[model samples]
Target: MIISCYNEEHTILQVIDEVSAVLPQAHIAVFDNNSTDSSKSLVLGRIQMLANSANIDGGGGTYQSFIESSAPESKNKVPKTQDFAAKINVESKRAESKRLDSASLDSPANDTTLFNATSITPTSINPASIIPTSINSVSTIMPNGGRLSLFSTTTQGKGAVIADAFALLDADIYVMIDGDTQYDTAFLPQALAHFCQNQLDMLNIARATINDSVHRKGHSFGNKLLSTAAAIFFGKNFGDMLSGYRIFSRAFVKSFPAQSKGFEIETELSVFALQQNLRVDEIEAPYKSRPEGSFSKLHTFRDGFRILFMIFQLLFTERPLLVFGFLSVLSFAVSLIIGVDIFMEFLETSRVARFPTLFVCVGLGVIGVVLGVAGMLAHLVVKGSKEARRMAYLNHKKIL
Candidate 1:
């Protein structure tokens, strides 16, 4: 499923077509997150065309099976009529059946056949009553033998869109990519192979090589810094923590608590997997900039801060001891600095003159000890919660 937002009107169709060509067996979904441009219309048109083609192909099989199965019963004919008049009536019936068969071929009856059905009564096929004249009626559309859905939404946020997708879609492997043509569909086979062959829960496609000059330097630098921070806290080596191209097993997608509402979705996903101790792997894939006139929606500094904040948030929530322990160490160090100055003053002079410094030292030391103890207690709570979460994840059936 590809979650698209504003202003990808130029490359949206290309992305859809290319992904379909590469993964012919894959069902493609396009979620239009309320684009102001003609993106929704363009995608809806192309997807409908794809659906029609699939329907024609699948409906042909269905129609053929109907003919073959019914042919067997019609082959041994025992005419009930005993006169020439009845013979003429039989001939008329044949003509009517032939006319109906021809009409079925031209009618949108095949449009309702959702798959290449091996068993279907010829009598039940009905032509589509109303041809879709606009996108408003597209909600009733269903492609034959293949699944393709186009949805329109008014909300923003990439993570929110993806969470909705995970809830709505039931697939063995759920894949997500940026709607813009940054990631190539050519590497999909290799990316999927890792999950199939190994014990992998999530596969993140890293943009190892930046092929286009459109990628800003700040974006690259921020990614490296954030990746480093994530590694330090989460203990997982991620090449591109910000990469939008990712694949998740059905279990992971179903159990993941996606709380992020914005671009920090990628970070949240990675952290969730790590927190659960799920097997995660990464593939270094090439990144291409969008086609001419297409632009990125990311605010580097703004999103970077959000990503950083999430890293710390997860660090505290998932590994409270480490974060709070570090705070405790810092506080103790400050207290020691003040205490040492007080000690030096007493050593140089006959009496200690700084009463405020003494109080400040005592206060910081007490805070440090209190935080350290709180961290220890919180770690136990976090441990029990993690155990429960792991059990819940394990109880869910594995998607094969």
Candidate 2:
């Protein structure tokens, strides 16, 4: 099962086509958010919420066997520099060999690949790349702004909506891709097989390749900066923090707590796995710029700031001591910078020249120091509680 949120026409069409070709048995779904373009025609229809009906309820959610579950929802990329081309070539070989068609495809040295799939095309091929197979979460939106219900997707964001869609369909394996078509569809089989073989909870296709362009300065720079910050803040080794290509198993989707409303949905999903130490996997894949008609929706300063703030928000919420302690360091840096300025002033004029600067610096420094110490104590308490919970979880799982 595959779920997608599409805001553009050309990209959405290409994305639908590509996945259908690679994973023929996989279910495809899309949630359109009142797009102004012909993006509707490109997609078969819109996805909606499950209705309280006799057939839908009695048939036991026909999708339930394939997807994760029904849900009350809210809402919820690419590639490397050119020099990484050689690495892609190498990975391509490994991937072909690493293709897992069933319950096998372990780590390395043992995987399966059928020769007939050799004609699989990359997303950059053209608009006519792949074709649509089957549709599950179907919807229809009249141009006048009201949704004329054809089928219920019952989704808000891309991730949450699709998660529910897959659950409704009862799909064992679920895939996610950007509506923009930047994430290569050729890797679908590889990711799918990887999930099946390892029985992994999730597999994300990190944008590991791209043909760089300077058309969208704000989005490009924001993405790069965020990627760098995420590496440091979350200790993730991913090159692209916002890569859209991902795959997951029934277990992960069933238990997935998808609570994000926008692009941040990806961050929420990735971090949840990393933070919880779940069975998550990463694969490098080709990336590309969207077609000309589609507009880039990234805001470097605004969105980047929002994402950065979200990281801190999650960090502080999850690890308060770390957040407070880090703030204390900044507070100390301010004091030191001000202290140096004061000394320099004294050296030049042989007297204290900046009483305001000294006062402000010293005040902040003392407050920061106080908060830092308090945060340390708080962290110890939090840590102990977390340890207890972890032990309980482990014991319950019979792992302890």
- What lDDT score belongs to each candidate, Candidate 1 first? 0.65, 0.51
Q: Best candidate per lDDT, number? A: 1
Q: For candidate 1, give the lDDT.
A: 0.65
Task: Encode model 1's per-residue lDDT on 225-297: one tens digit a residue.
Answer: 9999998888897989899998877678768878888899899999889888898998888888778889888
Estimated TM-score for each candidate: 0.75, 0.57
- Candidate 1's displacement at residue 216, Å, is 1.5
TM-score of 2: 0.57
Model 1 scores a TM of 0.75
Model 2 lDDT per residue over 1-400, tens place: 3435445776775665576567532335455554567675555432222222212334222121111123322211111122111011112332233221111101111112110001121111111111221233232111121111111344545555554444443334556665777677887777766766776766878776466572366666666777676667666655566766787664555555565555666676676566556677787877776678776665567666767776766676457787898889889988888799798888999999779888998898998989899888878876775565455434423110
Candidate 1: 10-residue stretch with minimal lDDT:
98-107
Best by TM-score: 1
Q: C-alpha displacement of 70 in model 2, angstroms?
A: 21
What is the lDDT, from 0 to 100, of the residue 4 in candidate 2? 53
Q: Which pairs of residues collide in model 1?
A: none
